[model samples]
Target: MTDPANPLVSTEWLEKNLATPDVRVVDATYYLPVEDGDARAEYEQEHIPEAVFFDIDAIKDDSNSLPHMLPSPEVFSSKVRKLGLGDGTRIVVYDRKGLMSAPRVWWMFRVFGHRDVYVLDGGLPKWKAEQRPLDDHPVLPEERHFTARFDTTRVRDLNKILGNIESKAEQLVDARSAGRFEGRDQEPWPGRQSGRIPGSYNVPYTNLIDSQSGCLKAPDALRRQFEDAGVDLQAPIVTSCGSGITAAALAMALDILGHRDVALYDGSWAEWGLSDKLPIEKGPEASASVSTER
Candidate 1:
């Protein structure tokens, strides 16, 4: 079993620890185009009691044309401080689609040098299904001092990915479905092309999670999923998806599984697919070897 005290905290565990002075919960829901409804509007209606809404779009680099790129460290610090997340706060992020968008916030915190954050396994649906409390009231959190330390090593830009195509310095993992990765289906984001970066692997984020429970699969199942997708646990990896959202989901899964040398491609297919010059491959899946260790 993966540790509840690690990158994931159970709904039951959150229920028990939610009131702890240093514990803070965030509703980090970002609705995909297919899933209709305004995230902010839904959050305002009913949410986990005492949970603050962490808007994925709001906490991003507004200067970037892309959707929800990581914000500057100073900006991140300012935004989080307003949310009352300080040095000692243990953040637990949840979302409407189970652990989908919640892990992105989890990754964002880690990228900004805060490691005390965890994602609420199964998220709010599980909380509500278990009859947990909800509060529509807004919380006016007292501003606290937040320090942001940007870690460049955790992110990959387009230039770096282009270099990797030839160098093969790191493995690229696409979190999109096989159909999308293979260019059999169109991209959800308009104007973006389908297909994946050359030499990238495919491990849909959903493979590591249970749709019914909204929680990540057991640790062994997660390992198997990655292994089946040709992900080398021992090698350096960069995860990507459409517009960088699901890529964070892969990062969160890897983090919980205790893999270290992992980074996320901030541009992902959103940027790469839009470009005409960048070379992309569309074809058969790569061969993967499941590890015999353990």
Candidate 2:
């Protein structure tokens, strides 16, 4: 169980308190193209009783070429309102694969000025394995008013990130695998150049998760992981992943570790990798043995 003061909540805690009027459970499941799975279809088949499926891909900056970019405040407000989210609601988001998609949704809510949100530790698999509860029927929710206030400061654009790369004003943390970071592996998206941004540290998102349990490791474990990876948690970090999804998991862990100034690169490698002009580096920096490319 999570401390009442913290943002995270366990499946057991959610099961016991889901009936609270102020609480809302959301299934924020999204699969990578490589997974060959349908998140929506799986949600429709079964989910936590009243949980609504929050489609991360469908709601985004439609005008942008980037995949699943953050949507405008008005757009987000209208969409989530239709999904029954309200200003006073305390949201608990979960994904089929634990720490994958849920933290992205949690960060989305936070960027929209909604702080009373959290990700479910261990997600649906853990809940099901424990024989807690499940429902296949569609959920019907009462309509509620949702107001969105986009906090631009919380998000960093491509130009801003590029400037940071040269200035070293903030730490760049890439969540992609070491192979992807070092330009040795091709990205899932074709035509994108392999390599990480110059000066960015390589800390694969998988390192932050417990492989067996599909949950975030404890804070001490997370600290050690970052430290061993040559990351300075005391410095401001801007996290990036294949797109912008898994980076949120890194951001969440940083938040849990009490690092306040963490931010996410909304375009991430999806944009950087596609461009030929962006600087790329291969091999690790002196600070860390992991290879990195830009």
Candidate 3:
């Protein structure tokens, strides 16, 4: 059985317990605008049996111009309730491109006080490579009561991040690629500047995952990745990425490493680079002390 505290579950565990009355699988596939991929259409083509699609774009804060920003508690509750995700359900989120977008959904659930949630380790790619069963039929789940208790501590706003620049109370850990973080590559969004938030450390999200298997690295390896990036594992950290997507992967990795004080910047570079008023830095990050303790 998968531990409740563990943020990830293997494909074997999911295939074994797929028929459990309380288990609910979610397909949270997302593609960047540059990729021009349609997540829903691909989900319609094939997915794990009994899996329902969780459209991050559709269930987001429509009022916000940014992509897939977290919705209000009421909105989240209503949308998830329609998916038959109630208090007792154990949700397992996965995505088409391995682990790319599933962790964000898992983080969203946790942010709204859903503790019985996990990401499917290795996601659909691993499942398919293992020759697991799949289905294309639509699933219309019965509506259920879902309560949302918004947890502010799991998320950080632009203003809070701006304040952190001065206080330095929490360390900023970025999950973007070295090229993008260093401003060598162009920003994905038009009119947005390339470069990272000042005083932030880089731990590219790719470093935390196994390139071949699409699964997250073991705890010790994950710890080393952060340590190599000069992250003090003992201190509070705010993870950020291109649009807050990969940031959740870092947050999940931190949680797995037993680092309790972790949060994610919801706007990420998408918002931070939108204006010239916000401060940004280029080239490699300045080094800092790494904590020896977990």
Candidate 4:
């Protein structure tokens, strides 16, 4: 059920339509520590004209110890308003390495009840490679009212995740790579466990995205991808990934597939993996037994 009006846009489409008054381009780039790239610094160096940098790290819930957890509705509204995003604006978000981090911002807007948002396919890399346009000029945006409608049902806290695990009320989906999900590879974060949450399915975020195009796959294609990975579309699903980044990608995929009940585990592996008391299952058995509970 991909929205006919709001499907992911390509670099060519953005280049042509960027000048539209209602369109607001945002550089939603975020880099991993392993990459050693500064997202804000890169955004400042060069970006799409009038595209402001949306700091994913800064708009997080500061009260939580976990990394980049979703902020409260009030906080989110204030931060987005400062960026010139409002109810009437049609947002187009992009990241440095294509589909890496922009989907998180796309999902954030949806969480706040904005449906006019989309991710820029192929991101800055493709845009620069195609020689579309780039501007180093700083943008000062006028303030506007961005109504924040916090959908509590779209988010799952630690307690809700624990309860879901115990009650088997929802299917848990992990977007980490197969190795990380199975504990065969170590976590990127120090002292964090490698395995996924109990009874979680593994559908790496990479699978849902086109490597070359950097856009999400078509709806039928996405459906098959999830089914092939053993995900039950009809069941309630909660998505998780390392530090809650890629988990948002999973949530975005579900959104395009018309799965409205999907919830994101904000703490994700950052919180769950670091706790010694939490159960950790190793090997492919963890992935194999996914969705066994009805």
Candidate 5:
């Protein structure tokens, strides 16, 4: 049986419960522009049985110019309802590239107040490696009533991020690679500058996953990874990434470590770097202090 208390589930558990009436599987595969891949096209080729596709790009705040910002509660409810997700449904989200984008969808469900959602640890890669059953047929689930109660505490906006810079009330953590965070590499999005928020610390989301199994590390290891990256466990934290995708991974990791006061910057670097108006830092992390004045 899948542990509802845990944020993740093993492929073995999913394989056994693939046919559970109350369980719903979602393939939340997302690819960066740099990867030159299509997620839906992949789902058409092969995916977990009864797994519906959740397109982050399509189910977003269309009013915003930024990519994949959270949609309104009504919009989110409407979309997910059509996907057969609703009250009492045990949502199991997974992505093609292991833990990359699955956690983002998991976080989205939480933001909408769905407490029974979980990510499939190791994702499709690990499932394929083990030669598990797969299907190419599309699933059309009967529409269900998905109630969305917006939880503001789980999400942060550009204004909140800017305000925190001065107030230093919450620690900012960046999940982008060290190169991108340091401004040494080109950003995935065009016309955006490379760098990080002024005081955010780097804890590249990849560090939280196991290389061989493509699974998230144990709770103790995750704690050490964050501490080694200079994160203070007791403080409130806001996680950001290239476009708020992988940032959710950090938020999930923190949740796994039992940190309760974590929020995700929905705009993340995609919004912050688009304009030069925001202050940014271009090298290694400045210090352990929450405020790093530029």
Candidate 6:
């Protein structure tokens, strides 16, 4: 409880405030295609009381070729309004896999100008372990007016990264596994080659998380991880993962450190990896572009 207004909330805090009228809980669980798991099926099975399932894939821009790309302002507003999530609503998002995909939803809210959102620390696993109330039925949401003011500064696309790589104004942080970042492991997704965006640093999303409790690591530990990966805290950062899901975890970690200029590359490696034209780097020796420029 060091940061009461922290981006994350403990299950104890959530249980105490579960019945608050203005609080809306979201189950933002998402699994990779490799897992062959269904998020909706898991949410339907059991989730926090008063929680509604937020389908990460479904709520995204359908017109986008990449997976879970951010929707337009109108689309986001409409989808959130349907979920009864408004600008003023206090949103608490969680995932079944502890600290997995909940941060993505929290980041989405922030990008859409909803500042009062928090990710559930330890996520559903901690809540379940504590035997907190669980509801099998999804609650019917009353429609609410949600205004979405999309912030371009909080996101980066493929084209933006293309321009950024040359200027060396931003640090590219890859949150995928070391193997993936080193191009030694095959991607979970089909047909994509295994390699990281050139000049990107690897600090796997799992590094920021505690596996045992499903909670984020301490600030000092997170700082060490980023520093070890050669992330210069002073520079602006753009986070990327396999499909942009885990990248939010890195963004959340940056926010916790009070870094103001952190952004998520929504296209992430999903788009960049699949593209034949984009430059890809391999092995642990691959370094950030800023080094060469300096």
lDDT of 2 by residue, 1-294 (tens): 335346589888999988888889999999876679999999999999899999998889889988899999989988888788888888999999888889999999989988889999999989999999998999888878888888877789889997897789998898899988877787887677777888888888889888898778999998997888889988889999999999998889888999889899999988987887777776644235333333
Q: List the global CA lDDT of all models.
A: 0.86, 0.86, 0.91, 0.84, 0.92, 0.87
Q: How should the candidates be ordered by lDDT, best one leading?
A: 5, 3, 6, 2, 1, 4
Cα deviation of 259 in candidate 2 (Å)? Answer: 0.6
Clashing pairs in 3: none
Candidate 2's C-alpha runs over 4 A off are: 1-5, 284-294
CA deviation > 4 Å runs, candidate 5: 284-294
lDDT of 5: 0.92
lDDT minimum window of 10 residues, candidate 5 = 285-294
Q: Model 4, residue 104: what's the lDDT? A: 87
Better of 4 and 6 by lDDT: 6
Preferred candidate (lDDT higher): 3 or 5? 5
Residue 168: error of model 2 in Å? 0.3
lDDT of 1 by residue, 4-43 (tens): 4479888888888868888888989997776677999999
* Pairs that collide, model 4: none
Model 3, position 23: C-alpha lDDT score: 96
User: lDDT tens string, model 6, 1-294?
Assistant: 225347988899999998888889999999888897898998888889889889999999999878899999899999989988986788999998887899999999899898889999998888999999997986898989998888889999888888887888899999999999888899987878778777889999988888777789999999999999888998999999998899999999999999989999998888877867777777756444212211
Minimum summed lDDT over a 10-residue window in model 3 is located at 285-294
RMSD of each candidate relative to the true structure: 5.5, 3.1, 4.8, 3.5, 2.8, 3.4
Lowest summed lDDT window (length 10), candidate 4: 285-294
Reference-based lDDT, residue 262, model 4: 91
